[model samples]
Target: MKKPLSNAIKKIILDNIEFSTSHGFPNIVRSESFILKLMWILCLLLSSGYCAYCLTKSFQDYFSYETDTLLRFKRVSQIEFPTITICNKFATDLSRSNEVTELAKSGYIKLKSEFTDLTKFNEFFKRVDYYFKYNSIEYKDRFNFVGFDIDKMLLNCNFNFKECNSSNFKLFFSSTYGLCYQFNADKTNIRKISSPGKKAGLSLELFIGYPSKDYDLYKSYGAHLFIHNSSTIPSSEFEGISLSTGHETDVILSKTYFQKLPKPFSDCAQDSNSSEYIHSDLYRETIKLFGQYDQKSCINLCYHKYIFDECGCYYPDLNINKNLTRICDSDIGFECYSNHSASYRESKICIECIEKCPEECESIKYSLQISHANYPTPFYADFLMTYDALINNGSRNFISYSNVKESTLAVNIYFDDICYSIVEEKPSETIEQLVADIGGFLGLCIGVSILSVVEIFDSILRVILLFFSKRMN
Candidate 1:
């Protein structure tokens, strides 16, 4: 039964195939025109060959098209931080009998009596009797001073000292507060000071060096001569001194896609004749983006301006302290920093400016990291001992070195994946090639030419016009 059913289905398929070939399309198979038959066979063969060629060419073109992306690494200028200095002043002739008296004779210790006075002493030290019992009130106050000199201290260091030449210190301060001063002295001429309100908790940068070479001592004989006086004998002093020299910064470079490519080719290749394909003039574009300022300088200025506008004072970290009367106190600084941060997130002008900032021709994104480590831990201990001795003995002649244990920072820069834009050369068919292809297609399918198509269309239009005229008549 299964065999009979299979045979019946096969018989039906054969009958339909034979009927379609012999009866359904009998005009082509039974025609007597030998030229038409030959033409039909030629057309079929030519069309098949043309289709195969087109498929092969398309595959070849798809695989042969290639694009090359180049990666490049460049080292830009190094960025430096502000330098800090801790200076000490002596009030009496204790330098004559001190172990470090050479430092005083060498002008390391300057007589800065203006920093100490009866009013400041009385205000800081509630004991009024200690001021009178001392020989001279100024001498007693200067020798007994044990805090940072706020009023006379310059926030920016402008002195050109021969001893200190390098400027890479980010933090600077003295261990003892009395008669101690802090200032910035770096290659950058722009100097700034910590906010007055933030004097209590200032971070000191460790000065790395030998202790014996940098330490200085000043003995107040007046305080010792009067045994009944409350002032002590030995006191520590620091003269204009540099703590650390060099710093480290890490810079990492990476690549990103700046412009999008069109399908199968770059936009530049798509319109080679268009001006958009031309390389941008970097100088003109930079001027357009930043006006009169360069990229780095403009960014720095904008940041300073933003800080000043928001906080009512320029940042102490930057180089913009000209004609600025109102310096931001600690309270004002906190509020100003908060407002500036919020503006960065919500301000449209800032966002637009950042977006429009002109990038380099071979643009790369950079990430920076900074770190520091203190050297000669024992020197730091000696500094602390000196500070403690000064606090214990109001006028003790102790040696204090501004050259504390120095800190060294290491910067390591690494590059990641790099990407760049390139105009991909594509194989495009010329006008002649297009014409040949069209002609081949026409001949293969119907043995037709441009004239044949024109004649066929004209004949159809004439017949339609004749019919319309007959109907009108």
Candidate 2:
């Protein structure tokens, strides 16, 4: 029985162990080759994991650089748009045309740059009709002008216009708060009030930059004043006014030509720039714009949608500083002019001036022309007394850089028909090479993966052949 038990244990041990004898020399070599292949596979896995970590790090760095460059481009693009949007918002308030507003959003019509001839204006306005609807924004403009860049300023604009067609085009002037004039649907006969001076609401153009397309801030082409010099130019022509150097005159009151008295103040003197008596031709003209006694018959009939400066057509108790650059006081007579803003504190046009003629003579340069060339940024009242000459058609030509004897920063940018400015530089080298290297390295990864699979297949085939040979022996 003990012998049998020992035999059973030996059989159990034999079952657990693989007892085999090779018949030929080829079998031993083949067995050894299979063991070597298994060891190689273990090494291949370890090497592959290590290489994958290194490749991941390299790709991560390349991706980071590409992302940084794209972010910078987006920043610059944002800066280019705010200026245009701001101007569009303001113009939409005055014009009431959705067609014009849409063109503004698309960034086609830059501020200050004339939208070419009227033909262009009509075509562009027609396109403006397609996108944005005619809706009035509840709020007024809020510009952060003092110490901010274009990028920082756009954060404030919240106004959107209720764009209407030329048929519904309404001009809500301050001259008569209750009445708005409906100009012809087609923008023909632009400034055709019945009279000027005693009964006119001031009409003008404020040269603001395309809030978005203002590429050069150093040059003062951002917000200029385009006053319509009624005294210098005629009501018949606005495009014919020659461009003027905005040094002395900082603004261009577009309604100057139709101001009453049609008096030209080429060599008159006045008090400080703050006095109410220093009424611009446009101011004096306001009397004629709406002061007529026809109030009984045509109280609110003809003027359906007009924007008059004297009409009190404001946003109701809004503390918004008016576009009227010339502030007034109650001191009476041709007093001095002040540069500070009116706190609603200054006096309105004197009742006498509102009802009767001036004790002295009336100003010839109606509407107003704030030429930045002559007046600089903050224009003074005394300066308006000594006027040289005014332009009638288009913009008055200024002394271009070509006309100047010496070169200057101003000249470098403002030359002939257009302003030529130098562009800022950017990093273009390191970026290009890094991008190329990433592409090459990714391609190398595919090649390495293919080679690794081929080696694994070859090793597995060798192991199978060895196993067959041993079984046959």
Candidate 3:
């Protein structure tokens, strides 16, 4: 049996194996000197082992899912202007100042008087909830009723040298900063700016009225602003740019677009249907309330879920998206929130939301270079004051220059460059590269090509067929 097998192997190597690697194996079969045979066998084994190792490495690299970044600079005639959301640091109107003051004072008093007392704690919260309900803060029209109206905040607005007004803005309520106004948020027709200078972009004259006595809760000194995509929701409270009351803020913007590989190459969402995309109930609710899914909005939604889960009721300050009828009052729900207040303070504590909400494969972002100058010089101040008092008759629609430095904020937002960057993620080892690597390694180590592999397989198949024919006979 050993003789027949040896003969068959020798036949295959001598007659069929045509590659350079066949030299060593055939030499091992035919050599008379034992030392020469041993040397040939060792060469064959070593070369084959290295080839196997190289092929294995190539396969491992292919499966590793490594990524490479490709950065490209692109120049366009025009770029879409980012959505701008402006929120008053005060968040409430001066007219409602007394109401806000009384509510806050009453809330503090109730908490101080009844929170620690187990007997009155729950009942105190019930009354606080009643007060919130009476104020209609949790009602569907709460934004219109509670937050500062945008018409009053936007004193003058011009975009692309065209006069823009309240009609150009959409109202949205922020839980952290009461009412906010968003510009260019409509995705269907986002406004684009062609020129790249302060004179060619958006110019705004804002009147941030005096802060209320109860302004401690709002926690801002000027107008909070956000720059984001028109398709996405803005988290103004977390990452807003603050404009000082007396200064002109010029935001020089540089746009950068990002595109990432999906699925095997990366975990980023490919589209709305991707498994990595946010699919949580809170995320869906956010889409229904807001327009699209954003990581910041999803995180806020998760916090809302946490609030409901912990207090057994939704907090009145947060948007109510679920069907649950219970809203937290200052008594029980507020106390529960206060207990976990540290965790709620930072939205990143919502780990599940962070992990589940994969980033969009394609997104645009603007890097801002902000600079400030004193908004109104004495001459300009006098001019504006005269204009408001005499020409406009102190029209509430324009800035009240009674205290010009304290009441006015001028902002200019524009792109600094027409050229933008496109950052893309691509696979480091594509299938073609992997195949080439394998072939190169195989040829370098064992001097074997595709024909060599095919020849060996053909020999093996022939031997099997011959043996089966003999068995059948």
Candidate 4:
């Protein structure tokens, strides 16, 4: 029985082997056509080489780094017109002789040492009353003085005053109480303290700040001053007062950002003839995204609005209405200003409002150099000889009234040394494109589709399985 079974299995296996050998491979290979075989070998080599080359090229293109042009910086010239505010530090009772005397008599000699001779100072004492009156400092009372509004001062400054010549700028002035004074000069005459030579006549030390606030903002600031001789000033006053300006020690403006890019990309970034060249549509869109409010102005206004909403009144320093309906009473105003000022600054609305302010593309920062000289006023030159004649003729006010000397400010602004570069993400080829390239290369070289390769493999596997099954039976 075992011999018969074994013989039957061997016969089935032999038949299966014969069938597979005869049918599995195409008849073309059995015919041994040399040209076809050579073609097949060449196709295999070419297809593999071409596919490898395509894949390598696709990978390089996908991973390679390239400069992005769309988001680059443009090298365009721009003119910046800065807002100017002139703040006078002539306020505080310490500036007045009476106040200094009271402090000195109280045994505060340390404070007394800081005090300068009030009689020698013309601008601080003489201008204090006028500044106070102009700023409406008396609105509160003798005891409680509301903070001075530097913004309002800038708004109300008489640009047409006897001196200013720069038509490209706007000017603002603060009252005597606008800033506190720390006397650095002793009892020395004005000429000894100022800048030397003919370039000096009246010098002004200008401190610049932005988003003008109270005393806290004025600390740790930047300052710039200018010296005016007879040539620079329109007025005849040979002596100028040294004044402190701005909300801080340093002149502050909106923060600026510079976009740096490669030279080729920057060259063609914008068209000068286009209306939106300097301020592009993209910038406008960004502005709209932030709710259409100018960043700094919006924040300041929001703070003011918050104060009004909470206290049912506006701060005295603000330009808001001072009527019974809107203005806080002196007591309430001081309390609210003192208590809620900090809270309002830290509030969410304030933070959001400031955060939404658009960034400036460019800005200028400047400092002042001051000097003094003894230049005869053009108007007073003829009057020098006539003073004796006037005295002989009995003119009492002529000697007492000294001619007012004005100062000239010269500002030179230019770009800084820092370079900025703009960058963007590089785009890459998709995986689908890479696959297609590889497939096309294989097809063109081998005359074989993906389906053809799969079919060939399937036929070989089936032949092997059939032989094995026959052997087992």
If the candidates were sorted by their lDDT against the true structure, best first, what order would they fall in? 3, 4, 1, 2
Give the alpha carbon lDDT tens digit for every residue of 297-381 in model 2. Answer: 1212111111123332321111122332222221211122111113122434333233333222223222333323432322322
Local distance difference test, each candidate: 0.35, 0.27, 0.71, 0.37
Worst 10 residues of 3 by lDDT: 211-220
How many residue pairs clash in all the candidates, one count each?
18, 114, 1, 23
Candidate that scores best on lDDT: 3
Residue-level lDDT tens digits of model 1 in 1-473: 55664565555444433333222222335456988767656755666677568646745645544444443333333221222233332222332344433433343223233225746653323222112112121222333332222322221222222122223232322122223322343333643322211121123222222223222222210000000001111112212222232332222323232232344443222222232333434223333433332334334445555677676775432123323244444345645754685676577756544443332222212232224443325565475446536654513232443232222112222222222223223345444655677666555554545765565455456556645655576
Per residue, candidate 4 scores C-alpha lDDT tens digits across 1-473 of 56765666555444443333322223334337888766656655666687678768877875553333334543333322222333333232221235433432342333234337756454333232332333343333321233322321121112112232223232222222343211111213221212222222211222122222221212222222222211111111112223332121222122133332323323222322223533444334333433232223334555656787788776543222334346555455646755787787677977764554333322222333333334335454335326534643422112321221121112222122222233443334456766777667656654445765665565556556655766788
Candidate 3 error regions (>4 Å): 1-13, 18-22, 95-136, 139-151, 212-219, 273-289, 317-325, 343-350, 397-402, 457-473
Best by TM-score: 3
TM-score of every prediction relative to native: 0.27, 0.20, 0.80, 0.32
What residue runs in model 4 are displaced by over 4 Å at the alpha carbon?
Answer: 1-81, 91-293, 319-325, 346-349, 352-473
* Per-prediction CA RMSD (Å): 21.6, 27.2, 5.8, 18.0
How well does model 1 score by local distance difference test? 0.35
Q: In model 1, which runs have C-alpha deviations exceeding 4 angstroms?
A: 1-69, 72-321, 325-341, 362-374, 377-473
